[model samples]
Target chain A: MRVLVAEDDRSSRMVTRRLLERLGHEVAVAEDGEEAWLQITSGEVFDVIISDWLMPRLDGHRLCQRIRRRENDHAVSYTYLILLTAMTDREHMLAGFEAGTDDFLSKPVDEAELVARLRVGERIMKLEQSLEAQVGELRTANEKLHADLQAAAMVQDSILPRNLPRDKRVSFGWEYLPCEQLAGDILNVIPINPDLYGVYLLDVSGHGVAAALKSVMISRVLSNDPLGSLLLGETPEESVTSPSRVLALLNERYPIDENSSDVSFFTIVYGLLDARKGTFRYANAGHPPVMVLRNGATELGKVGGPAIGMIDNWKFDEEEIQLDDSTRVYIYSDGIIENPNEEGEQFGYDRLAELIAGLGMCSTSRGATVVAGEARAWNPTEEIDDDVSVLVFGGDE
Target chain B: MSKSYPAIDQERLSAVSGGDREFEKELMEAFLEDAQLRVSQITEALQRQDTEALRSAAHTLKGAARNVGAAAIANVVMKIEEAASENELPGSDLLGEMTGEIARLVDQVRSSGT
Candidate 1:
């Protein structure tokens, strides 16, 4: 260890130096507190400083104060300060401690007691060094995790529907917001043919990476090849499969495994839209009701079955809605309506319907944006706690 | 003679010296020079009736005397320091007693051949 001896008297300085050197510690000597401060600031770090309390220039207490200030201001390595004094009263000891003295020794420092105190200082220094290193490592790990999550979020965003099919009979718009870095909510519009399109909005049981991974898998299964998916019939003629049959296929494929520890489930609304006829046939499996924005807002798809993966071979009933050019249809996750305000009241379906109706003759895109904005505004934090998603179709105005 | 002052404590001197003859000789020589200077400063301060200067000079000598195991000199200097710290100059008689204690310590150091 490196030791610095700051004493105004030459004989005491020599005695301390000899004792420390004998103990196998490197020794540096300063005639007074001022010189000691200079050595400390010269960039050579010392482990311990043995300073005499009374000196000519810059007394030991003031030196300790300055050293403590530098440690706080610049975050320098800690230096254990031991003050040498002839005054053994409790009052002087308290004053020395308040001045940042780590230990106190009498005028004639005993070698045994000095050695014990230095050992304690050495232990404290070692502990501090180790703690600093651990904190540095944790900081690095946290940064890496944040960067990785951002990259994953970007990948998820890229898979959303873009350059939506242009049909004069209908238009589409959507909003997606994830409360965390990863979310289980997914929505997409797949063009099965020139006349028919497949649309879906799904919410898996949980959040974060596990739920997101399942959503991604389901998305790939549904949208990878639209015409070849369960959305179409098996007969080589490529007939559009009924909404009820497609949901039945999904129910058969995904069932809650009794053996698996992490049992999972999902709520989804899948539909087939005939753009020429403006007929939407959809099946809801334990999802929120689909809203039709006609005169006011009417709820549909409530006549369906329980959530997927809950029961095997559960028959999901289908429902159809005839949409005019001026009518808009919305498919959304429960996160939108279930979000709570400051008073713990949910932003229910009634409020969502009213906000959409208030849009009057706006475009489907503007309607989607306004509905999402209203849901976010209803909450005091202006940030939804769950994954909020909305898909709007139709509304030629 | 049942004197009030004993020049040195051998046990303490041995402990501080760490069985090093050269270091012991060095400490004795350093104390000899520093003690004479501190005693003369105390004398001058007493003549001028300066208690602060007397306290400071006595404190310096007290530390050196204690380090070298000259307990008698340290004890005498400590009394002078305590009096001076209270803004009271020691009488010429107390200063004489301290001077005599330092002289006895110097004789002991010389006679012991260290």
Candidate 2:
């Protein structure tokens, strides 16, 4: 190890340097605290320092204070300081400890005691070095994970409905807010034909990467090529598959494994909208009710069984609604109504419907965005813990 | 001819010097020069009645004297330091005692040619 000896007296400095060198350590001599401070601040890292108590410019205690301050400010490596003090009183020892001296050596240092103290310093420095290395590695790993999540978020965003289908008779709008880097909520619109469109909003059971992966997989299947054939019928001549059958097909595909410990499931609202005819046929599988906006908000209540994947081979009921020119339909995830304020009161279903009804005849997109914002604002912290998704269509006027 | 001061521990000096005659001689010479410089500084401070300077110089000399195993000189300087620390001026008699101990240690170091 490299050691520094700071003594105003030449004889003591020479003696310390000689003793340290004899112990197979490289030694540097400083006439006083000022010289030692210069070498320390100028980027010469030393393992141990033996400093005299009283010196001209800077004293040993004050020098130790400055070293400790720099160590905290810049997070420099640790340097074990041994104050060479003749003041062995309890008061003086406490003062030296307050100044951050690691140990104390008498004015006439003992060679055996010096060797043992240096060994302790070496052990402490080695532990610090290894801990620093581990922290560096963990930081690198965390950064890589963050970058990967950002990339995944971007991919999920790309799959959403960027450009809604253009129709003077039917308009579509949606808002998706993810509380974390990855969200379990996903929604999309599938154009089955010129007259018909398939729309869906799905929320997996939980909120993070596991739930998000399942949502993404479901989204890929829903938006896969030949979606019209997949959703409507096996052939073009066959009639369109009802919303209930489509949901049943989905439930069968994502059934929960009874043998495994994971009982994960999802809730969804899938609908087939006849844009030309103003007819919406939808099935809700343990999801929040669909809000139909006319004079006031009306809820298309639950019609299906439990949430999809919870039970195998369960049958679901379908509901159909006839919308007029002034009707706007909204299907949303449970995150909107379940979000609680600071008072521990959830933004309930009634509050959500009243808030949307107050918007009156606003455009579908503006209404969706406003409701999403209001739901977020309901929480005092404004930190949503669940993924929020809202899909609106059928703005005929 | 070899000479020794009763207050100076020869064994302690030999241990510090690692039984090297040249190194022991070098240590004694360095201690002598530092002690002389500090002794004069103490004398001036005493003449001026500067308790702070007297305490500080005495402290330095005390440390160097202890390093050279001159306990008699170290003990005398320590008393001077303690007196000044208490804001009490060292009288002529105490000053004379400190100087006398320093002089004896210096003489013994010079006479003993390593």
Candidate 3:
């Protein structure tokens, strides 16, 4: 073991150094506390410090205190500080304890006793060093794990739609906020033809990764299915001619209890729009009611049928609306109207209707902006518990 | 009359030294230096609200104290580390007491003659 010897007395310092050397230990001599402090602070490594309690230019007590005050970056290395003191008074011992001395040897030190003390210091240091190394490794591993989780979050966000199609004949807008790194709400607008478009919005039953994965699965299914063919036709009237048929197909294929018997059903609103005819053929599967605004008048479209994937043969209600030249339609998930404030009062459909009615006086773009802004303001401090999504269509050319 | 100072426990010391006196010495010096450096690092970490660094410094100090047979100091260091890791400062009194203990230890070691 390498030892740091701090002392003012030349003879005592030499004797200590020779004794340590004879014990097969390397020794570094510090003439006083100040010198020892300097050596330690210089980033030199030592196994133990055998320091005298009294000396010129900083004493053993001060050195021990400084050593104790030193910060440790890695694992603990045992630096045993043995205070060489003549003071045997109980009060003096108490003072030594206060000064951070690990052990004490009275004046006219015995070689055997000194050697034994050094040996003890050596043993303790090794134990601490190993423990510290293990701890450092564990800490590093934890940091890496945290970093990996964050990277996964970024990948999840990348899968979400970035931009929506913008046209003068029809306007499209949406808002999405994930409760966590991933969410269950999925919305997409797919163009089937020049004059025909399919707008789909789905909300899974729960939140987090499981629900998010399901929503993604549903999105993939819709993207690859033959549903796009239904939107393509010469006349606007032919587009989405059967809203109930689409629901029936989905319900048959993706039964909720097939994978799990739990409540795995989802609320979906699928609409086929014809730009030329200014009309929409839509089906609502136990989802939130859609809102229609025509020339500053707002009306809630009725909820059509049971949620898809709930039962094997659930019938759906098809709805059609002829949009006026200045008409605007709003469709959304239940998260919006069902959001509750600190007072436990939900921002119910009634309140939503009022907001739409008030904002309907302006252009579709402005109205959508106002509604989103107001909803956020309602609960500025608290987090939105569920995913909030909004889609607005029909703007003047 | 021969002065019979307490006999140093060679076996315990060797065990603590991991059978490497040079390595033990190096480790001890490194720990002291690190502990000193950590004081400033702790201050910076606290100022910047770096909980990770604060926790790390406290943990290191605690371990080093135990190795050097400073059990009381180790206990205090452990408390500080726990508080810092949990992102709570605990109380000013505890911090003050720890600082006082460390300062006194440094003073004693400084005064001791080789």
Candidate 4:
């Protein structure tokens, strides 16, 4: 153990130093409490300190208080303090403890008692130091985990379609929020032909790493690239896919087994729009109800079926709605309506119908932002409880 | 310097010395030099008529004096410290007496070392 003896008197300091050195410990000397404070705070580590109760510039009580504050900084280890005092009254001892003193010894210190007390303090300090090191290791590991997750999230964002195929007649807008670092929701825009465009919104069954990996796989197959994915035709000249065949092809590729505990599925709504004729054709899986805005609000729920990747050889029904210059359609995942407010009341279809009616005059991107803002405001925590996705497809004004 | 002051607690000093004659002599020499410095500080504070300074100087001297087993000097300085802290301290009379005793002890330790 390394010991520091702080005293205003030269003789007491020398005597204390000689006694401690005789006990097989390294000794550091301080002329007064102020010097002791400087040595301790200047990054010189010591295991035990024997400070006089009364000092000129600083005192034992103040030194103990400052040492206790250093304990809050995890980088520093605990130091055992033993204050030497000539006054041994009960009231004074109580005051010493209140100022963070660990132990006390009377003046004219006996050599045996001083050695014994230092050994006890050293043992305690060793235990505390090991515990502090363990905590530091855990803190460093936690920081690494957070950084890795953030990098994964950035990679996922890079794969998303940056800008939709430039079209003069229609505009596309969307909002995506993940409850964790990786989201289960994925949306994309693909150019099917010069006049037709395909838009898809898919939500995996669960959240976190597995669902995020599955989403990346599904996005690759649905993306506009034809050379790598199985969904496209062999010739580069004919790679675009039809809207109804999109879900059917994904159902065949996405694996499913009832016996497997990890078997999962996803919901989807794939739409094809013809800007020249104002025609919209779509295939809906087990997702949220799609709204068609024209003279008034109307939900197209007749073309609904089970989520994709769940049934084999199940023919998915396709429906088409003739769009007009005033027509704008909305397709989203179950995340929006399923969100519960503080009163446990859900933001249901009726409320969403009312919201879409009010947003009839806004642009597609502005409308998506407004809808997401209203849904989050309905909850007390202002948190989207699940992976939220909103896609609004509308005609240009 | 005089020998009228009370004798130091030899038993306490011996326990600290651990029967080492050379170590005892070194400690006594250091104590005497330190005591002289403290005596001057108390005398200066009394001349300045600063009660707070008197309280602080006496209090520090009390603890250091006691550490060398000088019970008589420690006792008198302790009284002055307590009284001055409460602002009821006596004047130069008490300060002179304590400084005189401390000076005499310094000389006694010096002669004994020879």
- Provide the lowest-lDDT 10-residue window in model 4 chain A: A226-235
Give the TM-score of chain B in candidate 4.
0.80
Descending-TM-score candidate ranking: 2, 1, 4, 3
**Which residue ranges in model 3 land beyond 4 Å of their true spot?**
A1-163, A166-168, A178-180, A204-214, A224-267, A285-287, A294-299, A304-316, A338-346, A382-386, A395-397, B1-114
List the candidate 2 regions with Cα displacement exceeding 4 Å.
A88-99, A227-242, A255-265, B1-5, B91-96
The share of true interface contacts that also appear in candidate 1 amounts to 0.57
For every prediction, compared with the true complex, DockQ reads 0.68, 0.67, 0.02, 0.47
User: Total clashing residue pairs per candidate?
Assistant: 0, 0, 66, 0
Say which prediction, candidate 3 or candidate 4, comes out ahead on DockQ: 4
Task: Write candidate 2's Cα lDDT for A28-121 as tens digits.
Answer: 9899999999999999999889899988899999999999999999989889899998779999899999999999987688788888888988
Q: Count steric clashes of candidate 3.
A: 66
The 10-residue segment of model 4 chain B with minimum total lDDT is B1-10
Worst 10 residues of 2 chain A by lDDT: A221-230
lDDT of the candidates, in the order given: 0.83, 0.83, 0.69, 0.77
Model 1, residue B6: distance off in Å is: 3.3
**Docking class for candidate 1:** medium
Query: Across the candidates, what are chain A's individual TM-scores?
Result: 0.83, 0.87, 0.63, 0.80
